[model samples]
Target: MIHPLDKAPEQGEAGLLKRLLRAGLPVAPTVAVALEEEFLRLANLQEQIGLLFQGVFGARIDEERLFYAAERAESLVRESYLLPERAEAFLGSLKGWQGPFLVRDSGRSPFAQARTPQEALFALKRLYASRYRVEEVLERWPRLFPTLDLVLVQEAGAPQEDPGLSLKAAELLGQPARVEAWEGRVVRVILD
Candidate 1:
């Protein structure tokens, strides 16, 4: 259920982006190669569903929404990891919340303040599906399409005081392997 890059050495700005969708990319071309490749890997394997949704939710979660959510989760996941320096800014704003909670974004967007569990589920589905139009448009001229340039605003919200610090601190307290790895990123990211 774990991937090599899932636990990264990066955090904060280099770790996250708060950018508009219609602006310039914030990451180096060299770094984007890895990002895009991982993105594509998820995209290609999405049809299988189970491979993409593990660890995020329990096996007992609603099967109906999970299937559609997994199929559409790529865009939100894409939005979450896009670097601030690499992603251009345009349109509405999207901010991540905590513990599978995303909200209080640009008004008129479906993801903002999901009212009920049903609303939240639908919001996630719609949010993930948001990028299909862009990709479909770009599909015609794949060569002309810019990678990591256009980034939408959205986050896979998690419940935490500070995501990088809190989660790693929790891990540092319990997991030896994770402690050594996260210790450095915590110091480098939080103290530096």
Candidate 2:
């Protein structure tokens, strides 16, 4: 059973029909009542259709997958509310992480000028196992960049440990950062 807050009177029911009537539907109120009943039936059918999906997919669906899918669906629904009018400055704040920067270096602190963004990001994920947990990091990153577009985080280029940039990250993550660079090669990051 769904909590009352999670339930609606089967959308397009009596209340909806009454609302339509009040909003100037010429149909009789009895028609509204019929529509409401029909809508409830449709909702029941929809629920059955969802059950059918679960039955067909059940053999392949594990509890973890179901939980993750449900969580993702809920998040999508909730995130839809974060539009420009509602989110304002609070939107970009998601990008700020309380943890350390997940740097993606190519094992060389100096840029090879050959490493692609994809390669760099992959390397970063490999270097920092804890930070690359995409879903969790993403939740925080939205505060920095509000779009649900994952590319914003995916395209953050490669972060290298440079004196200046390290200082920036240190200030941002609020920790003393030990700058590591390949000897004789300066650490450089292309800031987008």
Candidate 3:
């Protein structure tokens, strides 16, 4: 289900995004598509992972074969489209909002990559497809499967003088560190 940013779900990327927003950071309005929806779309693909490996290597699949199988599965998922209802919900959430929304994978490294409806769609698919990437398979296969639980669609933030801000949790010299970009370069780091 699609949940508004203010009502972000209790777990995963949605929660993190909400916390970031609540902290009064300059973030855009966001909505999170729950992990359950992604699980539904990807359960079949996950199930096919072993089969694909077996079909290629006759049941004794090595790391390379497993990776290849995962890649195949990711490709298939990339080819598939989001569920109709989810798509509708996504589009509906954008009502009254301006154009050029940014769609990001909540579970992965964040980026404001989508600037158009078509680009957003492709970004969403790519987010889902990232679950099956070779590195992902090498890291998570046999222990965990990737889930499509969190797609964050937000209003594209206007260009700012600062490129971005990054907070470091571990104390840097006994205090929290904040990195800020100035004039497109990391010119200052404040310890608070």
Question: Considering every candidate listed, which one attains the maximal lDDT?
Answer: 3
Model 3 vs. true fold: TM: 0.66
Q: After superposition, how far is residue 26 of candidate 1 from its true place, in Å?
A: 26
lDDT of 3 by residue, 1-192 (tens): 777887878666456445555665544666776544564445566556556656433346476776778778778777766767767777777777665566666654354566665566667767777766777765764544654456777666332324244552113223454443323322223344
lDDT per residue, candidate 2, 39-69, as tens digits? 2243353243234224223335354544454
Alpha carbon lDDT of each predicted model = 0.30, 0.29, 0.58
Overall local distance difference test of candidate 1: 0.30
In order of appearance, the predictions have TM-scores of 0.23, 0.20, 0.66
Q: Sorted by TM-score, highest first, which candidate order results?
A: 3, 1, 2
Please give the clash total of every predicted structure, in order: 17, 13, 1
Best-performing candidate as measured by TM-score: 3
- The candidate, 2 or 3, that scores higher on lDDT is 3
Ranking by lDDT: 3, 1, 2
Better of 1 and 2 by TM-score: 1
Task: Tell me how candidate 3 scores on lDDT.
Answer: 0.58
